[model samples]
Target chain A: MTGDGVLAQALRYLNDPLSWTAPGGILDLTGQHLVMSVLAALLAAAVALPLGAWLGHAGRGAAVVVALSNTSRALPTLAVILLLATAGLFGDTATVLAAALFAVPVLLVGAYEGVRGADPAARDAARGLGMPGGRVLWQVELPLAVPLLAAGVRTAVVQVVATVPLAALAGGGGLGHVIAFGMGTQRYGQVLAGGLLVAALCLVVDGLLALAQRFAVPRPLRARAAATAAR
Target chain B: MPGNPWFSLEWVRANADVLATRSWQHLLLTLEAVAIAAAVAVPLALLVGRRRRAAGAVVGTASVLYTVPSLALFAVLAPLLGIGRTPVLVGLVVYALLVILRQTLAGLQSVDPAALDAARGLGYGPAQVTLRVQLPAALPAVVSGLRLATVTTVALVTVGVVVGYGGLGQLMFEGFRNNFHRAEITTATLACLLMALVLDTLLWAAGRAATPWLRGRADGGRRAGHGQPARASVRAGTGTDLGADGRGEAA
Candidate 1:
């Protein structure tokens, strides 16, 4: 019997009805991946957004933000996940927390930079209008900073999705299971299918977020940019 | 009580040989991957930087390549390469490409346009202007990019344990498999982080030392002190060309 190429094997696996509808099928795996990634992103944002924004508003902690982000780049997410999972936490929880930590530095950096880079004239004007400092931050700075904040979140989400497969190593379920199982059993096609699925998910999410960012940007800013280009 | 397994001196003493071997393997693997990445990225960045129009496409491609999941890349490569050092090395090289490529392009374009004009005025040829004027000015950004890429690659080497590469990740996997042996996990984690930090600091120092001219310009002939060079403020654009403005403070 002739062996199929990886591409051919992947197509066969993907085309099989059982692969989609059977227990722990492709659709199920996709759902697991999405849930795990979104959970991680939300968790990261919950922690990073407040601290970053507060720091930006107060004009303090830039050093801390820089230090945290730099140190984070030097730490491996999978190792953290492994350490946590081995400590008897639920595999998924460990993976989510680890991924959240990985996601934080980017989100925090984005929030801080965006707010810090907000238009000083606008900020002063808001203050001149007798707005409280907190009000100015929430009402003026954050709205103007939406584009950058969205970009950060978008990047973090895509990364978290991609990293979620590491969880499969600790017995947490995701598309990584398909890849790992294929590797163990020499099912090259299953591996390909899993990889293709992940890539497709990343592209789709990124495209959607790009579209969202376009809409998320303040309408006035977009019009001004367009008008400037026209001139 | 057996004390904290993670901090166990006995466990570390027992596994000293393996730990030392794996750390060396990890360092070598990271160096090889970064070297290959820099070689490819530099030429490609120079080509793309010259065109300006190709900047978007080049950066976009690298970003997309980077977004390919690490394990997924390994899985895809394993079918053809059979899960060993080759696949791991290739995966890491691709991973490092975006950061290095983006940095190089940014560095090349960061040269002051006035400087380029001055070089041309002095009868310098295109190649001479690029090498003498542009590259020298772009040094800080490029070196900064290289430093970031090296650190990132070092951390990522730990992921190669899945593909059977014996980096520090091998220790991580071993510790993981043996019911989370504390000493093993803690030691591997510390070693990996330390390597990344030490390598980053060394690269940072090397960058500073290599660009004495930048410091001279920043200091305006004042004896250099511990303060960072003013050129350090130039934001290395990852995709967008900051152009003349990026070097605004460099002067």
Candidate 2:
């Protein structure tokens, strides 16, 4: 219970290779966390699209979506999982829903803003070129909005990946099992070790995104400005 | 749908004291975490913003922290700290780093580099330049980041229920646990929503107040014509500090 005891024990757990080599260890979590994280990002992006993009583009009654997103933002993942899980949904569905909800408001805000903030002049020019509204949205608007979409997806990835550990609480499983076990046993070393491991996972995912994110950046951002200048 | 447990104003009114007490406790928890988060994040952000490579590394670290699952983080912390405010506060501080670092970087980066050179030419040392020029220029972004942190912390602090700290989350979780439909669930849910709205508005106002030069009265036309000051640009569903640069134009 003392800080010294806890710190020493925690370090011991982290340093012990046997813990990992043992039957159920960090490796068990890798697959599910990966699945849940990606699923969370995809679910957040998908939900925010029509709901966020339409609201962003439509230009009226938009506050409703904003309000809803904000409201979702208010509800914590614990509250949502507890509520939904109690209603009979469990495991992956519960984790995904919790992660998706955690992600939605922020994702929607990005989607909405990215769409609304799309260069008006660019849209006008695309329309002038005879692009239909749908074509304009798909070709011009979405292209320009890709960065924002990517940005939202990136946010969801981090949020979902980090938070999926929460699934363990409801028996959904992930690094959360490590975390919850550590807590339940009053094993401070195990808790910090679990936390540190989860935190490391977050860093790896973020690093992967930094590289992957460039693909989502708008084409204009990618074009060498000097090359275009020379042209 | 038929039961509609949360719709009765009279029922909620009867428990106004309980609801209000929980709201205040929730608010206090949020404010405490935010205050601590700002203390650590702002200073660190200023320091990192000076070096490009370092900033990237720091930002990378923040992303990892920002996305941490609250349930697990708290669960991990709770056993060591053994429940209640301390562990939760620590988590919020970590969460704030994710936003604060990225936003602070954005604000600092956005400053016309020319301005810094001018300050240097005027004989400002690195310290003077940072305190006077860099910090001021970055203030708007800093405040915006703070706002995002505030909104986010307010939302997540509700998870403090996992540790049995007992705030509005207690009501929300209890409602969920007992299947106490409308009265408990309804009351807690509405309180959370209202608190979120109120906290968001307060943070938005705080951002504008902090950065008057950015939201100059002339920009009143911008507000009237466009929308509210694009404070934090948090894309609700996603967990990235992406808004830091997403609508750089809007910010």
Candidate 3:
């Protein structure tokens, strides 16, 4: 603790009250980061969820879903942000749009796989019980697909949160502003502190979503998942 | 036409040399990172083979590393390594580790138990069984992991711009800094996307070539039952289907 190592300095920087309550303090930046990430995720889910679910239910376009998921992984967030921002979009709008575009493939693939992987037996039972096709999809398939769908959302949210930092490079607001500022000034301690903050945020968000994923599944499905894990 | 257009053939024609250099750098950096990651991850996976506690610990630590943003990781490393390709390379390798390690372990675990038994019955030693029997069988999954890692590395190499080593990302950054040079940004971005797709197709073809037996299975009914679930699970984000499928086959 006495040594003036980079880690020690970073720890000191994080501990100071000034870092938390300054004009663009950690708290302020964190709020910006979360807002952008959440908005982008919601935007992505609105489009991806319904489309993926409908496609999965219809048992169509599985190949396209797989292809999109693979291709999206290769689309750099930095490139996307730069493209949109330079294409005449406003800074915050560009950031949100890029993040939403990055999140879509994961959500789409998740919803598609979730609904497609639903138990055929349950669907058959619902059909036999005089449920219409639409009712069977609503009552049987969607519920069964909840776990995987939540998992996808969890992954997408974490990824978007992680990538939001790149928005700073494009003149947008976020915790990335802290890192970008540190980099500009060659302040290693501040840079490390910013990195730590972003990493911590990502882990916390991921952990919360992981818990949500666990709880979102129907009780019976949760029990079955637990049983499978136990086995 | 009302300011600079999104794309311009003249700009691309003039900057062709710069574009090629950046594209090559991007490709080289991606290949190096993934190759190094595969080298490290495969050995680590083999060392931790079949050990549940060790595998859990290793993968848990890796997933934590994986969750850190690329820019943040580069920032943290820049202090230690000094701004350059080394830190970016190290960061890229770290990001690739979780995907590659998980895939390798999953692949090794997916090897048929009967194959191992057969190797042993023929007086094969443990090392021999691992090398001669298991490795070949797990090749498909390992290649699959490599494909994921490679694609991820290609995307991530752009973040290296934080340390001034972001390959095509540097061009994208430059475009933004230079009053939003539309053609420059569009060209670089498209190049990144094109590189990713082309690399993926190449890897997929290589995987197909390396595993000829799977082609035979492709022509059989079991193909639907075997391939679809694994592909679905991978895309769905669980990525645990290789091991699960092996266990199911054994059962």
Candidate 4:
């Protein structure tokens, strides 16, 4: 199609939110994907954060956990969705599994890094004060690592937002529906608009994550400043 | 359990040439994506480094790019780019952004301030200082970014299988679709892990090589080595950067 046609198609998509959200219309690209993504990220955080924290705090197991998570991350996400999809987990179940698997590395690593990188002296001081392992972790380690944990969760959420669209092919719903519709028809504009929206959403999520990080974490080391200073 | 019958030694040996072809194609696909990623990320980072505020913008944009769920992202682009390697590379490049930007910024950030001043005091222009002083300092970070990008690219390369490439993920996709089960899935999984691990180690070493600082090299040996360091050069690192970005310190 000509440029005008493409533009018109794209505009049509943007203007027609109803087309995307009208109850199973256009693959349920509305809040369904976001809900799925957030839930997936939370699931990832739930498992990875605690496990990562344990591994990180234990001091000796950090490498093992990191290695395992790192390896798990190698599992192609699309493959994960496909595998889960065929397992009859599309819709709710697929999103959950995909998010859980995808989120693990982020939360695990972030939590581990957050806690491990905390001021050792602080940990020492906490221990000296007779804090039990549970208390130290809950009160000290987790708090110190809150920002990192949040960062990891933010990453997982963003990933899930981007990823759950694949569920459309499996009968799950979200922005991927827009993409699939466009693809089925060889419509570039639809794809572009759909992709653009997804990217924009991800960017928004990333920006929010940055905001969360700034508040959750202490004063961030300004890399720009550091870069200049280092030079 | 990890060993599946479909990927039996017999099947592999019988089709060793075919497997090799797939391996090579996969390797080239990954490297092409990574090479393009390095090319784009490093220079962009340098530009960003020159203007600190913009670097954040670049990285911010990149992190968002990282989150585009691979297959769906590819499917979205399939109409425009026409699948195969094009969209995959596009996706991979976007993924590389956070890594490249962060490392570029990191490399610039990691530079020794005193050295920059010395270069400037010697009447060096902006160009000279960046080339002779700042770039060298940022090398380690650039290297680190490249290293991360390499591993990420390796992992994400499998996404290409969705659009009809025969990478390891293709095997997994086929296995899953045809009901070859975990045995078949295990091959793809192991292949991915092996590829990621091997590449990670190589790049980890390369990152050290890239970043003289990471290696704690002394004297002139540090600056001249590993080119400009990927920290200064590579702008993309992803899980496919796995959505790692400068989560900002404000929170």
Best by DockQ: 3
The DockQ for candidate 4, computed on C-alphas, is: 0.32
- Each model's number of backbone clashes? 3, 22, 0, 37
Ranked by TM-score, top first: 3, 1, 4, 2
Candidate 2: Cα lDDT at B48: 78
3 or 4: which has the higher TM-score?
Answer: 3
Q: Which stretches of candidate 2 lie over 4 Å from their true place?
A: A2-42, A50-71, A86-88, A109-126, A185-190, A215-231, B1-4, B7-22, B46-57, B79-82, B112-138, B179-182, B203-251
Better of 2 and 4 by TM-score: 4
State the lDDT of candidate 4 residue by residue for B1-251, as single tens digits. Answer: 34435336665566567556666776787777777878877777777786767867766565445555565566555555665667777877766655666667766865777898888899999889988888776665566566566666776777666455647767666666665454455556566667767776676666565554445423223332221233222322211111222221111
Best-first order by DockQ: 3, 1, 4, 2
Relative to the real complex, the DockQ score for model 2 comes to: 0.29
lDDT of 2 by residue, B1-251 (tens): 45644457876888789888888988888888778878887888788777878887776555445555676577668667766788888887777666666667777876778999999999999999999998987776676666666776777777676566647877766666565454675567667767767876776676666666766444332231111223323222222222312211111
For model 3, residues B148-242, the per-residue Cα lDDT tens digits are: 77888888899898778999999989989998888888888899989987887787778778777777553321221122322433333433121
Better by DockQ, candidate 3 or 2: 3
Chain A accuracy as TM-score for every candidate: 0.92, 0.86, 0.93, 0.84
Model 2 TM-score, 2 decimals: 0.74
- The CA lDDT of each predicted structure is 0.73, 0.67, 0.78, 0.63
Task: Give the number of the best model, judged by TM-score.
Answer: 3
Model 2: CAPRI class:
acceptable
Worst ten in a row by lDDT for model 3 chain B = B242-251
Q: How high is the TM-score of chain A in model 3?
A: 0.93
- Candidate 4 displacement at residue B58 in angstroms: 3.1
Q: What is the lDDT of candidate 3?
A: 0.78
Model 1 DockQ (Cα-based): 0.38
